[model samples]
Target: MARTVRFHEIGGPEVMRLEDLETGEPGPGEVRIRVEAIGVNRAEALFRSGEYIEPVKRLPARLGAEAAGVVEAVGPGVSGFAKGQPVSSVPAFSQNDYGVYAERAIVPAAALLRRPDGVDAVSGAAVWMPYLTAYGALVEVGGMRAGDVVALNAASSGVGLAAIHTANRVGATPIAVTRTRAKRERLLEEGAAEVIVSDEEDVPVRLLALTGGRGAEYAFDAVAGPGVTDLARAVAPGGTLLLYGALSGRPTPYPGFDLGMPALNVRTYTVLETTRDPGRLRRAEAFVVSGLRAGVFRAVVDRLFPLEDVVGAHRHMESGARFGKIVVTVTG
Candidate 1:
């Protein structure tokens, strides 16, 4: 029997319960994994709280998206993966729900990616979602190119860090925006060409100055609402504003005239849209794996908690004290 975390109802972290269940062998084109680490993302919180666009099915839904483990069993028709091979997967939403928080999980072969040699389970689990989102937004959707100036809001987040690293890899200058002044030096060290303390500095003014009065060529905004308007203002002529997240829990108001008149493109993207396309997913995974293997990108784990203490982990993530990814270590 596999031990898994299940939630009977949508509400606070207290609603989550740990239970024991029998896990069957992987079906065709699937693989069973002995889960080591599971990533805790904001999407999980939204799903648990019933705030996400997609509705959670019935009671006792398992919760999680990405995980890292060693392959325990490879189902029929699965090739190239051996027993005990280290792997990571972003399971399909339906199966992903209760499985990733369990001691063992079954996932499709297509979702499976081998972990890089030196990457640990925790870091490996952290890599897929954020980096994939970053890659899709910046390169695939935004069409970021060399010498482009990119501005990323919530620049201390996992996705933000991924954006900075992606921009660096593409030979673009990444300007990171953060509300906290303390994270400036760390952002710089992480490949941000410049860091803007949004709460302290005039964002539009500083952005214009940084771009030599031209403004950033691309803006990645996670914090929506009034801040998005400012972000649109800082976009250079013919620039793109990719709004991927709404951390503020409010509606984003945009000045349609400003965007339309100057031919500024305002695009909203979700990881699902990008990953749903097999070819895009393949490209994203390949690039991310290569970056991990080459040490061009590193997963930042703020803290790890036992699966039993998931409530505490969720609270910590909600507290906004964490600067990077938070993970849960699932024990067998």
Candidate 2:
């Protein structure tokens, strides 16, 4: 029997239950892993609370999409990966189709990535969502280049920090935006070229001044709330504003006044676009691997919880105080 995290109803973290589940052998083109570490993301919290993009269709649904472990079984037609090889899970399918918060789980063969050297199980679990999301949005879609100025708000989360690292690696100037000055020093220490405190300063004004009268070339936002228009306004002409997450639980409103500039592009993005496409997925993997080998790509683990403490883990994530990714260690 395998221990897995499942929720019968969609509501709060307390709805989650760790149960002894019977995990069967892998099917065709599938791989089974003995999970060691699970990445805890806000998306899972949103998923369990019935606030995600899709509704739960079945009861006792599984949770999580990121983890690292050694392969325990490989089904027919699977090549390259052998038994006992170290691997990590990636988001290739919807959470409703598969999840990783378990001592053992089976996933599609294509959704696994080899763990880079020197990266432990916890680090491997933490790297997937943050780096891929930033890479897909900044490098692949936005066409970020050296010396380009990119502004990122909510600059303290894992994705936010990953964006800063991405900009640095590409020789771009990353302007980190925050609601307060609490994480300013840390952001700078982590390679942010400039830091803007949204509460104490005028964002657009400071952005323009920092860019020599021209606004930022691009702005990456995770908080889609009333302040979206302001962020859009801070973009230079022909620039793009990528809204990736709605942390504020409010729709990103496109006010009438800001629509005057036709060159400014406002769009949303997802990592699945790169994860599912073979060529793009390979490129993304290579990029992440190079960064890791060069010490440029890193994961800051905020805390670790035992698999059964998933409810408390979600509660801590809701507190908005963690500075990096949280991992669930499955010692079983």
Expressed as tens digits, the lDDT of each residue in 219-281 for candidate 2 is 998998988888877788888899889998886787436667557888888778888988888
**What are the models' TM-scores?**
0.94, 0.98
Off by over 4 Å in 2: 255-259
Residue 119 shift from truth in candidate 1, angstroms? 1.6
| Residues 211-328 of candidate 1: C-alpha lDDT, one tens digit per residue | 9999899999888887787778889988998988889899888755745667588888888766667888888888897888778988988899998899998999888878779999
Q: Name the top lDDT candidate.
A: 2
TM-score of 1: 0.94
- The candidate 1 region of ten consecutive residues with least summed lDDT is 90-99
Q: Go through the candidates in order and give each one's C-alpha lDDT.
A: 0.86, 0.90
